[model samples]
Target: MSRVPAALTALTMALLLCSGSALAKKDAETGAEPNTQVPAGSRHYAATGFPDRLVASPAQDAARGFSVAWRTDTSVKAPVLEWVLAGDSPDVGTPTRITATTQALTTELGASHHHRADITGLQPDTLYLWRVQGQNTWSAWNQLRTAGRADQPLTLLYFGDTQNKNLSHVSRVMRAGIKAAPDARLSLFAGDLVSGGDGQDDSEWGEWFAAAGWLPQETAVAPAIGNHEYFEEFEDTPQERRVLGRHWPVTFALPRNGVDAADTSTYWFDYQGVRIAVLDGTSALDLGTAKAQAAWLDTVLADNPHPWSIVLLHQPFYSPREGRENTELRDVLLPVVRRHQVDLVLQGHDHTYGRRGEGQGATPQFVVTVAGPKQYRLSDEARATMAPVGEDTQLFQVLKIDPSHLRYEARTVTGRLYDGFELTRGTDGRKQKTELTQGRIAPRDCTRAQTLKGRADRCWE
Candidate 1:
């Protein structure tokens, strides 16, 4: 913001980064408070000429093609992206080279150029080898595959709120999700990829990248904007503006097909038979974009071409915590998705797991999950509305879906099944869900009644 001086801003950012690094060590692994905090040095992932943070993003229609984005220092001259179909022979065909579009991103540490190259006009279910040119060298070729037809069986990896301990604890959940669903087409995130409270911290973003490693390069990632993603708008500061972190735009290169206020955060992508409509609840509640986003979501779902519509957002229609009463959010976006018969709604920000709307066969099944080390207690109000809730655990979800049915499994970071369910679409479009909790782990919460009655067997210690 012009209201804040550059020197003062940098000093504040440095102090915040140092404090954040220290707080990261004090995690919420157990239900009780963690008593640990060690001072850590400021971690600035300074960029170099060689390309880093290379990620592949899905287009509006992933079946047609995808996009690749990477970061390089300013010295990288004429960065380009080269691509060719993956074939039995390594040198089967000549590569098509495209010059990348560059955007200069200046963080608290320094400045770097983020480049994105869009690859379109490709066939579906095809594998391709793509690489990007750095300053003087080229990144290793990565494999990318497009979505297939509507009837094709699709697997997807869904995560919620890897907002803290990204490198230390969240990395295991990310890799486990990939391992559980190796054939997954799109890796979708509900929100809060980082936990930067003040503003953009390049170090946190770097940890997220390192946690995912080659996962994003191999598969496309679609992120719904969370509350934390929106930090103080100082990068483009005129002060008093709470905009999304500057890293989001150039980092992901998502489709610009949503409402005007939050285009990148609130957009949709079609893969096979699924249309993932991403909404920005933070923008809706904070920036007064609720009315506009509701209308846009109605329009998008009104003309939906995909059979299975899954909506992704940071705030949930139902919260696992009592005080997280997002009545405004639910009032605006809930009816739109329900009216359009959205198959599933994925969400985060509660730091817990909950499943609701399974009774009497609801159109959009609501699921709130957490994938990081942070934990939160489930409230009695939340427990009354939602079922099969879990807290103080890191979890990831793997969904196998087709136009007819969806098989959902929630697994812990150590590859243990925590919750399971299946939803089958009826001929008239309503889905009937069957709880498949035969082999699921015990319910994690210890109820007050069970505790008062001294029923040790009814609760998990």
Candidate 2:
């Protein structure tokens, strides 16, 4: 093997050694030389605080409860939140205040922290304004709606991979998705939350969170473990890589409805009338820990008692990308999902957008999409298997569900509705499907799309 540059190795080592406090000190004393800790007052606003990664869950039960999550710097004095009902006019009244804070740690990049809190005692289907703060810094207050009730209709946004060009390019797509459904109950990520691999370095995770910003704090997120969350085997000793999963538990406070053995990230939640089940596909597929998760998945599905059931994960079982298919996931997980009458299966890993069809009754619709700038080509056979497919850059789907029917639309980054459909279940126990006539705009060339076999990028084109 070639000799590694000493400077690169030193830089990496120094970054790895710095704790959150040390990183804060480094940021504080940057004007001076190294090896000194600056006073806490010297740090900038962003250095001490920033609101981000907001996601909202649908109003549950009587539409009185919703949740949000975000991240901050370790130096944050105390995390606090204030919220109130939304108004058409700007003169918003004061809201009940809640005080919360997060713990921080250091990685190869620098110091970081995560915060998650559920805002309860809300009015049904009503919009409200909210914001977060740390120390002297305060966040701009945003608005969100709580779930109305069990019989009320609701909309949600679903995405695949936003791992590449996360904060820079992908942010626009995320923002567009937010605007597209300003009242969406929540947004879902089908894994690949970041482009991290092997080394959970700063760039990988920072870009991902930056892409979402305070959206996580504003909404409730159900994140699955994607392949990118894992590192390549070479970076770690064999044993270390085997036990690796994620820091999701520390990031978002999801409902603990999954297998007791699995962590919080791989769990389910009943938001309003929908029972959302999220699985750790990367762990099952790559970590040789499928049995435990599989058994847990079966139990969760068997126990679900909601009007609609949806599953989210990183890998796509009905993949159009070459070598990217998850046969084990399909055989093991799909049957369970089908048996439980799962309404939809959302995923990302192919880096393209597509949806698969089921011939009839309560058949699950499989969708894969990409919100990041990095794009991938789809396989020719994918066109036949999917209702619609898009290459290059694009957002994915916005789904509206009610007791009588389900509607979804797949839009591009430019706000063009590319594909759409509706699934309606009638009183007679028959299911009907209808496809909307949406023309394709900028579908790209995919002659050399990469073939995804494992976690690595296999092709440039």
| Winning model by TM-score | 1
Residue 292 of model 2, lDDT score: 74
Global Cα lDDT for candidate 1: 0.81
Candidate 1 local lDDT, 424-443, one digit each (tens): 88787767778887878986
Q: What is the lDDT of candidate 2?
A: 0.66
Question: Candidate 1 has what TM-score?
Answer: 0.89
Cα lDDT computed for each candidate against the true fold: 0.81, 0.66
Q: What would the per-residue lDDT of candidate 2 be over residues 1-461, giving only the tens digit for each residue?
A: 55575556657645544443464455345442221122222222123356654444433332676655566777764577778888887788867787665666555444666666667787777878887775576777777666666667888888777765566577777788888887776788877676543233354455566666656655555577677666554455655553343455555656655665456547776666777778888777766656777788778778666567788888887887866768888777777877776778888888877888666554688888877655666787887777567776567578898877788888877788877778787886455777767564545444544533222342221
Candidate 2 weakest ten by summed lDDT? 32-41
How do all models score by TM-score? Answer: 0.89, 0.78
Could you tell me which residue pairs clash in candidate 1? Answer: 1-237, 1-238, 2-237
State the displacement of the C-alpha of residue 307, model 2, in Å, after optimal TM-score superposition.
Answer: 3.0
Please give the lDDT score at residue 19 for candidate 1: 61
lDDT, model 2, position 419: 75
